[model samples]
Target chain A: MNPRRRRGIRGNTSIVESVRLTKIYGSGDISTVALNDVSFEIQRGEFVLIVGQSGSGKSTLLHMIGLLDKPTGGRILIDGIDATFLSDSDRSEVRRHKIGFIFQAFNLLADLTVVENVMLPMMMIGNGASSAMRGEAELVLGKVGLAKQVEKQANQLSGGQMQRVAVARALVNRPALVLGDEPTGNLDSKSSQDVINLMKELNRELKQTFVIVTHAREAFGNVDRTIVLKDGKIESIE
Target chain B: MDFRLVLATKLLLKRKGNFIASVTALVIGVMVILFNSLIFNGVAEGILRDLADYQFGHVLVSKNDGNFVNEDLQLISYVQTFSYVEAAAPRLGSIAWMNSTEGASLNEVDKIVIIGVDPLRDPKASLLYSTVNEGSFVASRGQLVLGSNVASDLKATVGTRVDVKMVTASGEDAIRQFVVVGISKSPGGLAFDDSAIMTVEDIREITGRERETDQILIKLTDRSFQNELKSRLSNAYAEENLNIQTLEEAGEETLAGIRSGIAFINLVGYFGLLSASFAIVTIMMLMVSNKTKDIGIIKSLGGKSTDVLIIFILQGLIIGSIAALSGFIVGSIVGLYLQSIEFSFGPGLVLEVVYDPVFTLNSSLFSVVLGTGAAVYPALRASKLQPIDAMQHS
Candidate 1:
């Protein structure tokens, strides 16, 4: 509802754009290219998946797009702003305003309550613990089917429940883009299917762009697009 | 509450054992420092009290190059005229030999310093009357008050007749018999331990030195006026060839030694704080290692590096403040207990613990700064961690 956020939402249809992004690990003879000149674009309100094998740079591309890791070459743009050259503080600001991330391990701060975990992004963006932020967090948790577990410590939750808390946390800020790197990788098959269905449902309802990287391509059933990579290079886009 | 503080509290609570250990370390450090400071204060206070109450009154005025100051009554009257001077009394100091005669037989002979005081005026200028352990202070010309050690050495008691022998001012040997009236135990160091007190008139009559005394002891209404009174006395008696000294000036060497001892205690206390700081550093480093995943999660949630830094720093600060306050309370309780007990170093020196509020507050503040400083490196390391790398850490 803030003027700046409204301006951001109205500014661009392309939520994310990666142009020849490359990330290399190590150096000299032992150096390995984690991502090699990978290029992609994700539009607003699109549900997209990045599919590849274990070493195919799917997580790398997702990390770069989320602004959690910088590309060694090329550039990344989030909500039409060039993000690759942003300072660490500026990158954090961009990430706070424009992107949300969910990891395979759920990555909830175990010591915090589920509501607290969900309220973290909003608090980090200087919203404080205002009743509005708290209400929004509770609303998001309710949407993720975690209304009853909101007061429980994150560590006390089951994998499915913890992932639901993570989902609530990711969407609490209503970011323009949400990135997931194997979000359901550690869940049971039923739990995984349930989480994927929840994510699809939330995407349909919220119309926020979602970029997910995973090995279980068939589980997605249908998405707006899928970017396939092989050996750190983009092989195809469907 | 700020999210950083809330997260820091939760993080510290999550590791209860480490948190308690860190607090205990800092508490011990603060207690050690406070204990050392209190002991130093106690010893210094005991020494100064002994000097002011028994040996040196607040100011001592003596002849610069003679055994006695002539016209002592006039000098006493002149000194007492000052509003700050509570009382002025004359004292005559002489080395003498004493032997106790019980049953018409001399039991033991001892060499002693004899101090002659004005019976009425001396009581106002010194705590001699209160220090009498048995009988009472000298009230008449022949009455004698014996120090504890001198009384023990001479095998004398209240009502015992003792012969005191001394060389007169005219270089003639003189002897007089006196009955002991009191046994006084003044822990004003060795000076008062091997001495005896009697009426100034009695000493003058025995030594054939009438109307003269060794020193004029001046007690002040407040001890802080010692220097000002000394300066005024010096100026007033500039033509009298007198040496005027303040209590501090007279006890300079002993005070210097005590100062050195305090410095050493402060060094030891700082070393204790340094060791505690090291424990904090190690504990904070371990905390950062254990919370790497949390750091990554926070950063991934759009927390800046400064946010992570502030969280860790706040943890250290909270621990330090709690420990410091606990240590101060515990230390004060222990100091009060110590104040109830008496510690005697020798025949006439007893010490009781003392506490100063300003010193205690400064010590606690120092501990807080050290604790906060100890966390800087670990905080920086946590703040600088890359979100991706930290998330990958298992």
Candidate 2:
């Protein structure tokens, strides 16, 4: 284990758990191995990074864990509840009420205002936003240093500011887990570092669980532990 | 506003090209249907009004002979005093031969339906007197009025005398001499333009139908009273000597023909709207395709499939409402424009088209429903987009 990895036995409750997870692309002879028999558990409030080269299944693993895609075999437990058996709508409900996603390209609906973007999760939770249920999206926007930009549309912001807006949106629901798939993929070095520092700050302060998939090591150096993958298998834990 | 609608509005407002195309399709569709339906509706109303005003005269009372009035002058005169009778008049008609005194046999026309009217009450019962342009209506027994076509055929003019010959009810050949006093125009542009009019005394003298009239024409305070009058007449004159019927009965076959033509017109309108709905589906599908990534983002943000569907459907509904309202306004104006058109048909028949467009609630509702329904498939396709596929697309 890397020196920065915390030394501990995760106690009674884990926010997420994966058991013998397997994913394949096609059927029979033409099939490709994307992930193979991978298993892991995530403690609440832990900051974890899944690191690998391109096509090494880091993104695939993130997708499966986040419920963005289905696994070919194995089970995923979110907040200690088996999610593998949930209906499609139920899985969407789980994503709505429990999980938050941060995409690399900062998918902050460009047509929506920054505040409106932050309220997206809450709106979708209602399916058709109740507007009465809009909690503290503004507070989360303020926390991401976008207090003054709340009324501005998402497209009006810069790369770093857009990512911050997205971060604000992801955390507005106070979800149990936040999954980032190459969160800084489209940003400059400084913008990438700003987004990473912001995620770490929010993780520490809010004590929210995080699982990020990335190849960048410098920005994620302070994560609690990093799972290193090579050729669809975990090579080591750093 | 629900966030679904809010997002839907934002998407449409932000995408000017798609929004304009969608709205244009709907507007053009509704406009075509409205304009066509209005024009046909106006034509049907004009035809029916013409029949009611100039041909039918609300109700007609006839006898078994059909041409000569049965000797029931007392009941007709009695009906004239009733509250429902705006005007009641006796008319005598016979198939006669007429020729101008100055012209040879070439000027004679056979099978001329010559009708005699009372100069006093006929004007109130039939609006034909109002159409007399150059002469006074039949003023007395020896006077006659000629329709434009009949005047042309007989080579008769004002102050010209004509000889009318017919077989009387007694089976004897009889004749009368009539001086043409006026040339009357036919308001209806119908075959009546080929008929002649004279005093009831003139037709009676020629047909030997002493003190007998052929048909009793009645105009009522309200046309709806015809059915009640028909029943009352049947109860009073149930002997089959007198028959009461609505003027519409005379042209039921013609009206049925016109109705079929109007049905075809309505069908064409429906097809126009159908093509327009297809256009909506095509353009909306394009919009959905362009915004697939947006779909994924919404899904990732916790939006359900139903929310996405609502957004797209709401966009279409908005377009439909705006287009339908605008089309209705424009169609009303067009109906007014068409109402002003006066054109002539067949030999001196100047028709003033009375265009009264009728818009039904069901038609407007149908437009809205069709416009919104056309977008359903596109919306469903957009809603079915996988969040992962959307994210991958970008």
Candidate 3:
């Protein structure tokens, strides 16, 4: 890590870091370390791709970074705040206001329509944000090409369409970081391209940080950097 | 969480079949509990009013051997003592034969209990007087008030003179001639339907009874003190060979039998309602199981465990409230309908059922409490579910 190399990304800053993060499941002889001494820095407005095979610790790492889970050891810093020391409710606040997540399964609440799913985060803010933020939700959906399908239920949408709805929902709050885990895993190639392009567009236009975990090489087209994880360790950062 | 509430309600609506089933189970539970309360309250009121109006006048005093006071002079002395005592009267009772000439004619005569009463102190007198149609209860010399059944049986009208043959208390048979001064309709049932009423002296002379009464009817200032007064009087007049008893204690064995019978019915009714509560629990547990995945999703999306608890609790409250209100409405309607019909108990006692408003409200509240109580376990389980496991649930 040369100072000159770090200085090349001028005026841009890293909002996340995993300081010797480790996660172990089980105990005694059967202990399995899911994440071992994993460390990385993700900068603002950077569309970084994490490429890995199955069980390569990609999802677990992404989950830890997104504050959806707690690391068994080590501290995760988000925006210079020590996230591991925060309370469960405080962690939830960080997850709500600071980060957005898109899942490979397109975890849209099936009971809600596309528009309601997009308004999901706004509603979760608990201040009755629906009345005030509805227009923003509509605009985000329009950006994701889901304006026509807004009233249709999530269950009625195709795999690709559901992924797009999930994306709209993730970005509805205008979060600082968008952490997607295999977001295009279940979509067709064309839909995957559309979703990937949308993420890139959001990162470029909104100066939003993007950290995506995926195995599809085609989905990472023209990303600023790719961090390849292998056997619970970083293999390369290109 | 605002989103959790909106999402939970949507999930409930989406799973409409499960929601309907759960609500139905709760409604049935509520109905059973409410119906039992209505029946119990109705029977209590029904029996108490019937005894108070037709048989016991709040209290009764009598000789230890159950003989009526026959000396008119002694009776007046006893009657003048208590200022709080509203009415005191002596009655002589005996079994007699009644042969009905209409409605049904059997060769075997119907046995009826004859009562000797002071016409002025009898509440039944007004009702009997109104039903007379042809006679008066003036208790003139050698006159009688014959019940409708007895009058019909003997084919006797107010002016008809009939012979009443009976044995005096001395075990001697006597036949007395008397004009039917009044013909009164029977009060559906009790012991006196086919009975007749005579002056105290008439019963004593005919029965050869000497200064004895079957019972003394004592009306008190407060009906609740009937038992207390009966005990006190029994102690006060221990030497007089008189026994005082409240209507409930007087018919102790009978009332105990009635109470036990009603209690057994109520126990069975509660058992059924408890099983209905179990059904409600089952439905709620199923709801929790079905929504496990949705719960996980919401938790992951910033729902606290408390938020989950609120959603389920609100659902249970809604279900319980609706069921309680519906059960109350339906139960009252049914109870009121049953009250509209007049039923006979036994000889001079007809039961007119009255729907108790207090019981209705209490039963409604009971249903709500029971239904909500049934949901507490399931709601708690829903709240304690792990977000990770719940999310992974299919």
Candidate 4:
């Protein structure tokens, strides 16, 4: 049996569900629609990619799916729970427990050690820096091949290593879904390929769901599926 | 450790320049407050000491009118019976003309007030013995302790014989000769600096009033008992028509002025702390602006708005603690050094620096609270930041 269909609300396999989502930037004449009635679902444990041109709403959809922003019109469900109308605190709780994020900038606090950066999500979840939490963070870092560099400051790591640390941080809490926005945009071609490959390997090993927004679709080979966007609307799901 | 604390400390360390600047502001403000407290408290203490030691004892007893307090020995004996009464002494005050016989002086005679006291008991009731700079206090008949100024005016020193003329109680002019036994100095600009001290027996003999006293000065075990003792004495001596006054009542105007000055100094000190609070506000605001991306990152890592707020607040607390501790140590050292040096306004008048531990501790705690308060707005701004907006912020 596929692990993607193994977890969630009984028969439901979708980790993220967006229905008729619309996000408009401004009010009247100057207003621009960033997402126009876009609907999509990312199954549990599925490695998915959202590819689009500039201003094509790929990142907008990701933001809606991650619950980082509210949609002007529509609803979002995470693991079969209605997330669109949740209060800010509730949204934060959901984000803390069920989702993790990776940015193109890697966004690691430069002054903190690599292990400390990885421990951030657990810390946010109210698990203080206990020995058990430290062990868990170390175990995650080891999975990302950064066990040797756990004590090094985040800024000292190369682009690929930094992204690996970011990956470790995202997975340290064992979130139900992970969202990445241009995760490899700041890296060289080789480092970018290495990061994507690592994410693919992590997804296969842990059966973790991934939804990445990117323009470089070619680098993300062998993904479970690809959703393309154009003019703030879904063009295809392949 | 909580991650918020760890993050706050790391962020503060990352921006060493800003942290140092904020701490410097608080340090200066705290030091200013502490120094203000030291100088004002010292001045107040010195003035109060002078009033108690030289002008009035802890309490004073006099006749309601200007007449001499008759039967003063009985009054002194009664006052000394109280357990809290450290000592009591009778005093006789009179006006006379004195001229040094050994000096080349014809029109150099000076009019002065004479205060007669018992040599042995007076030292317990007052600081007369400590004020003597040249010779001893009056111990025998015809021996006088001259004020520094009076001695200077008469060209007299210890053992200089002077002739004193005054109207005796029988309405007849009487002249007497006395040798100056001591030269005493008076700080706080009291009348003692221009008068003479003699034994009460000699004063009564010259005035032809064998058993009369102008007033009785009483010293108490502790000055704080002045009010309670005053009330008791007032009731006990109501029929005698006596005027009983505490040291505070005798020098009310001077003490009130000093208290007002201290209040103003305290206001200015707190104002210094307020200015330092503004520095904290500015520094924290700049920190928020610089750490926009970091805020977004933390939020994306599932940090709550409250978490962000606490991180910045913790930063302020850390800065305040360090600065307050540093300022207290520096202020205490400087206060001690000032106390060691003699800063005189006039002869025998010097500035005193006092260090009150409770006051310093409260000032430090107040600084810490103000620092944390100053960071509120900036911390709120950081907490309210949208993750998307912050991540997009350049």
Specify the highest-DockQ model's number.
1
Model 1 Cα lDDT, one tens digit per residue, B256-278: 99989999998998899999999
Task: Assess each prediction's global lDDT (C-alpha) against the native.
Answer: 0.86, 0.78, 0.71, 0.85
How would you encode candidate 1's per-residue C-alpha lDDT over A1-238 as one tens digit per residue? 1112212323454678777889998899999999999877788899999998999999988888988888899988787787877888888888888888888999999888999898888887766556888899999988988888889999999999999888888998999999999998999999999999999999999998999999999998999999999999999999
Write the number of the candidate with greater DockQ, choosing between 2 and 3. 2
Minimal lDDT window, size 10, model 4 chain B: B101-110
- lDDT for each residue of candidate 4 in B365-391, tens digit (9 for 90 to 100): 777887788888999999999988998
Q: How much is the TM-score of the A chain of model 2?
A: 0.91
Cand. 4 Cα-lDDT: 0.85
True lDDT of residue A155, candidate 2: 96
TM-score of 4: 0.90
Candidate 2 structure, TM-score to reference: 0.89
Q: How close is candidate 3 to the true structure, as a TM-score?
A: 0.80
Which 10-residue window of candidate 3 chain B scores lowest in summed lDDT?
A: B100-109
lDDT of 3 by residue, B1-394 (tens): 3665676578777888876776676566556655655555555555655555456656766666656444433653564476656666666777655432333543223455677776666643123334444677645448887877677667777776666767666677677777778876644343344678777667777777766677766666667777666666667666777666676765565457667877887787677767767877888789899889877666666666777787787766666677667777877887787678664444434444567767766766665676677778888998887656787788
Give the alpha carbon lDDT tens digit for every residue of A145-189 in model 4.
Answer: 888999999999999999999989988888989999999999999
Clashing pairs in 2: B68-B214, B69-B213, B69-B214
